[model samples]
Every structure is written in C-alpha cells, then in structure tokens.
Target: MTCVRPRRAARRTSRSANDSTALQALARAGYVASGVLHLLLGWLAVRLAFGSSGGNADQQGALRELADAPGGALLLWLTAVGFAGLALWQLTEAVAGVPGTDKAKQVGARAKAAAKAVLYGVLAGTAVRVATGSSGGGSEEGLTADLMRAPAGRWLVAVVGLVIVGVGVFHVVKGWRKSFRDDLRATGGGGVGQAVVRLGQVGYMAKGIALGVLGGLFVAAAVTADPEKAGGLDDALRTIREQPFGVVLLVATGLGIAAYGVYSFARARYARL
Candidate 1:
C-alpha cells in the first residue's frame, strides 16, 4: 500500500509539470504570433496612409500584387488560427486555474473572451451574409469614395476614433491592474525585453487614441470632400495639411504607429517561443 501511494504521487507530479510546460509554451507561441501579425497590419496601415498610391489605378495594382503573395495569405491564416488557439488556451487556463497564479488566469481569460467575442461575432456575421448571398456582388471600387462623400461620413469616422480610444484606455487600465506588471518583474524578465513589452502596451493605447482623433477629423471633413478631392490618399494628406495643427499631429501619430510595428516585428524575431 505504501509503495503504491508513492508511485501515484510521482505520476501526478510528473503530469502536472508537463501540463505547466505545455501551457507556457502555448502562451509564448501565441504572444509571438500575435505580435507579428499586429506589426504587419500596422505597417500596412501606415504605408497606405502616407504613400503616394493615392487610391489611383497604379496604387490599386500594387495592392493587388501584394495581396497575391502566398506568404501574406499564409500569415493571415496563421494569425487567425493563432488567435483562436490562444483564446481557447486562455479559457482552459482560467477554468483549470493557471499554475503559480489564479489572478493571472482569470484576467487572461476575461480578455481572451472579450477579444474572441468581438472577432468571432464579426466573422460569423460576415460568413452568414456571404452564405445568404445578400449582396448583388459588384466590384468594391469607389466604395471608399462613396462613403467619404456621405453626409455623416466624417462623424462616423470620429465615432470610430472614440471607440478606439475607449479600448486603448481599457487596455492601459487592465495592464496596470493585472498581473502583467508582476510578470514583467520576474527574474527572467526586465531589461530591453521588458521595455519592449511596456512599449507595446503604450503603443497600443496610443494607437487607440490616434484612431479616435483621425476618425473624428475625417467625419468633420465629409462636407468638404470635393469630387476632385475624392477619398484617396491625396485627399487624406491634403485634408490633414489644411487642418489647424492637424499635419503635425497626424505625422506624429503615423510615426508612433510605425514604431509599434517595428517593435512587434522585433519581438516576433527575438522573443522566446
């Protein structure tokens, strides 16, 4: 009886250790993949905002060419898969309770659920719409122009900006209140890597605020979108330049976004798992 009890205890300990290792690996992999995806998307956004493409035929051609890349498609799919996996892992961790910390698991689970709910809701809605064949299905050309020309287009943009700002603030508060700070302070942590993590959080919050501001401006400018002005990069740049102190703010925001992308890319390349 004594011998059997000892063997059972050993088996349980080994199993627990293996589970911990697996969960940590999954979490790290998720972090790296998500960071890379964000960096890629951020770079694309900043480029489109500042580039000379201006929504012309040439620009459209370039975009199509890039979109055709197999690597880009793979990355897109991988990111979606990674996000789903991460969300599931988080939920599991929360339910089973993460080793070494219960609070961390709870906070992570809540965030994961929120993120999954939003992403899944949108994706599911899109899938339903496509399956139902609701649209007449024409080329999406001029959609941007049409929207920008709408009476409340600028206002719509501003509302989106405010929403982004709200999200950023939420993240900032969550990070400060959660176990992230303690995680950052652990022995294997700190130094440039920790700084980078902090920077990513800061950048995320900044991005939300920037988006809110940009959306508001666009909404305000809906009335002024000249037929010649259109909804191209040229018009966007021109509008920014014409607004009172808008250009400086826009430029700074653009750089902030670029920095976030660079940081994410660096994290993907060098971070553990």
Candidate 2:
C-alpha cells in the first residue's frame, strides 16, 4: 500500500510538470506567430506599393507581381503562415489573459474591427463604382474621379480618406509612445543613440504626416469637384517623373519601403505575447 501511494504521487507530479511545459511552449509559439503576421502584412504593403503598378494602383497587379517574383512569393507565403501564427497566439493570449495584456488585447480587437470596417467599406465603394460606370479603373485618381462623379459621392470619399488618415495618425502616435522606444532600444545595437531614436520617431511622424496629407488632398479634391487635384503617392510619383531627380526619388522611396519591411520583420520576431 505504501509503495503504491508513493508511485501515484510521483505520477501526479510528473503530469503537472508536463502540463506546465506544454503551456509555456504554446505561449512562445503564439508570440512568434503574431510577429510573423506583422512582418507579412508589412511586406504585402511594400509589394503593392512598389510593383510595376507604381504602388499607387491598388489592384490585381501587385498580387500578380507577388505571384511571379520569387522573393515576393516567399514573403507572401511567410505572411500567411505568420498570420495564422498570430491568430493562434492572440486567441491563446486572450484566453490566458497574460499580464499587462488588457491594453494589447483591446488594441488588437480594435485593429481587427477597423480592418473589417475598411474591407466592407472598400467592397461597398467598389460596388458603387461598378454600378455607376466610372472611367477610372484602379488608379487612386480614378477611384476619386468615379466617386466624385456621383452627387454625394465626393463627400463620402473625403470622409473615408479622412477617417483612414486619422486612424493611421493614431497608430503612429501610439506606436511611438509605447512600442517605438522599446523597438529602438532593442535594435539600436550601440550605433543608435538618443538623436538617432528621435530621428526615427520623427520618421514615423513623417509617415503619419504623409498619410494625413494624402487624406486631406483626397478630401480637398473631392470638395473642389476635381479628381485631377487628388494627390496621392501616385500623383507624387507622376510629378517626380517629370523632374530631374525622378529616378533618385523613386529609388529612395522604394528602398525606404523595403527597409520598413525589414523593420517590421524585426518587430515581429521580438514581440512578446
């Protein structure tokens, strides 16, 4: 009887240890997956922006290019895998309620909600555009033109653009105050200092500013009833193409976006669940 009791106790202890180990492994996997998703999304953004479509036309061109480019294909695959991993991680985290997780969970939920809203909005807009028989196919200007041709469409487009820009600005600001400092500290590797960090922060702000400007221009153009005045990155590119430094600007912007992808990769790899 004494021997049997001792064996039973040992088995219970081992089972507890196994359970704990499994829980930890699950957590680690979850965090890694989230990071990977972020990286893939970032890559997708870059591919769409810089492909032959001039990163301006949000159409099937980018997807086709991604399918063709070996590197882009790999990134796309990775992105999908990463998204799955992130979803799993977020689900686990939500269930476990990890420490200091409330804010992250809330933010994540909001992001998902916002993304769904955008998706629905885009679909609805596309339907309207198709139904109305607008001329502009995929170009930002074309989208604006299509919308503007309708009686109340211009205001709607402006509102959507403004809302998008506002959301982007919020991400930039929140990301800077919370995640930016930590990311800089992690990536600085001695070469980065306070000034460098500040510059990076400014760069994030600049990105937000660019988005905001693009949004405002979209709104203004709509209000003026002139889609030609709707200036976006595509317009910027077109304007630059006529200038002496066109190639230089194009290359610079392309490289900058690529660098951003790398940054996103790093962020995903190191993010704690």
Give the candidate number with the greatest lDDT: 2
Residue-level lDDT of model 1, residues 1-273, one tens digit each, is: 999888677546544643665644544555555455344334444454454443322122222333456765454344445544445455443334444556746666556545654553333232233334343332322553565457776555445445544655665464444333333333234586666665655655545544444344444444455323333332343444455776465455445554555555454345432
**lDDT of every model, 2 decimals:** 0.46, 0.48
Off by over 4 Å in 2: 1-65, 71-75, 81-151, 171-179, 182-203, 228-233, 236-253
- In model 2, pairs of residues that clash are 35-268, 49-55
Index of the highest-TM-score prediction: 2
Worst 10-residue lDDT window, candidate 2: 55-64
Candidate 1 wrong stretches, greater than 4 Å: 1-26, 51-70, 93-113, 116-164, 171-191, 194-198, 214-247, 262-273
lDDT of 2 by residue, 1-273 (tens): 999888677556533533464543543443343333323333434444444444332223233334455675554444334443334433343333333436747666545534643443343343234333443346667878888778888888888678857965965684377446553325545654444444445445534544565676677776787787776554543443445765554444434333434444444444433
In terms of lDDT, model 1 sits at 0.46
Query: After aligning candidate 2 to the native by TM-score, how far in Å is the CA of 60 from where it should be?
Result: 5.9
